[model samples]
Target: MSFSPDRSQASEAAPVTGSAPGSASGAFAIATQGLSKRFGNRTAVDGLTIGIPAGTIAGFVGPNGAGKTTTIRLLLGLVRPNAGSATILGHPLTASPSYLPRVGALIEAPAFYPSLSGRTNLEVLARLGGYPTSRVSELLEVVELSDRARDRVGTYSLGMKQRLGVAMALLPDPDLLILDEPANGLDPLGIIGIRDLLRRVREQGKTILLSSHLLGELEQVTDWLIMLHQGKALTCGSTRDLLAQRGELVVEAGDAMQLDLVARIVSEADYVVTREDRTLHIACPATFAETLNRQAREAGATNLTIRVKEASLEQLFLALVKGDRS
Candidate 1:
């Protein structure tokens, strides 16, 4: 997708001093340098540095125990870093008050009174947060909870509750929104609902930092990506550029002998090939698919089929983590 954040609605961003691989050149909504956090002897985050450009949806991707949550906490000031520094919306980390007002977050599961109606809940929160109650109806509509606005929270489904949580986070009309696993416990349709909602939110010129294990969904929506492993950032930059780095051509044959011959043809061409049953996975650019097909045919391999496949977020993450381990 295209990223075009309305600068008029966004804060004045700082000039880019450095760039991450494949990242766009612009001011960062969030930037960190050597940000670290530890609990006892276990390091939750280690020497992490990243830049999330202003007015884009950046995905926070990581496996279990990969410090994704810790990093979010540190960024939200729920937990302080052991070392390093960060800036949010041009304000230093130490000055959270200056930036927190313009920021909204839905971390983990959202909590609400079970007996209260969804609209009432938001109204209460808006009043307590010193925000006008007029935003309640608009937010309810935005989250698609207006139909169920009068229903008690106790009767709402998991998806409904999640949507309500999002509405709560958005009460302040924040410039930057942070969401952690908003799709958790949601069905496929629910997930799609959240995805559509996020795009609509982004259309208003707001920046979003989304953390989720749903890489496939993230791959579709995120303009930038920050991949984490074992308390460190393995990669951070544009999602398209990173995925473009790796691609494969799958060549299949009617028989094992033909597959071997096709594999040999690709291997002889100096492309790395992995044999799996009757398929040859050749590590090369998608553009090489035509050449591979022709070469396999020339090698007397009939009934050959070749398909170009791009590297998915899951594939890239597994490859990077494996490389890091090695």
Candidate 2:
């Protein structure tokens, strides 16, 4: 269950110093500064800077073409950055060899021999990676695939395959796990399984960088969040901190005039308001819900319904991206 490697085996390239400004090198499992990558005239990642604390599930999210994959490639040393620097597991990007062994990644769909049993596929990977064969069995148990270990991978469901992929990543007993869309194409139950598995992985003291588009699912599991847009980090912080920044009061009245009155009241109070048919969406704190309800009643609105809604990951993503574009 231990992922700690011998400190003596660490890179001699000297640990990166203050790469994330105001934070010590040991503060982050992954840190990047001014990291940029380009493809001819198109920039994939632009001066990207982010810090993912150790031993936490950090959600890596963005719209398509946001440079998420490119950043992952850069981190894995699959591609060279056109500019900036990065550090993984205390080793600079220039010394990826020293740290990559401790990092496990499953980017995109995992490829496996359809005809091979799930156990055999893992055994093959373990042998090729020089990992202990015993880890294969242990991982099968961890991914809850032991019952189906002898089953052909072709017979496995997409969820099972994803779990197997995770098992392969865990085979290295990595200290850091980076998964790109592990829940993609999964049903609700499969997604829940992945979430639970991630929690189990984190309990083993592993830091996880989960890149996924399922914001609702991410909101449930991620302790930290890094929102990417146009190859740059638009916002990165603890999930609680990010979501706490915005909330809304949804009000619906029996008549259009009542709705308009409620909207005017919210707007006059300096809160942003948007009208959609009979509903009034007021951007404000949840704490104001009581006051809003009282105000509507005092405004002579006989039939009114009000609800306070917390900001969801989807809402935060849209708000951040919209603000960034503006």
Q: Cα lDDT of all candidates, in order?
A: 0.82, 0.83
User: Which portions of model 2 show Cα errors greater than 4 Å?
Assistant: 1-21, 249-308, 324-326
Q: Write the per-residue lDDT of candidate 2 for residues 144-210, one digit (tens) a residue.
A: 9999999999999999999999998888899999998999899999999999999999999999999
Model 2 lDDT, full chain set: 0.83
For every model shown, what is its TM-score relative to the native structure? 0.80, 0.79
Residue 110 lDDT in candidate 1: 96
Residue pairs in steric clash, candidate 1?
none
The segments of candidate 1 whose C-alpha lies over 4 angstroms from its true place after superposition are: 1-26, 251-271, 275-280, 285-307, 324-326
lDDT of 1 by residue, 7-59 (tens): 11111222221233224323889988889999999999999888998889999
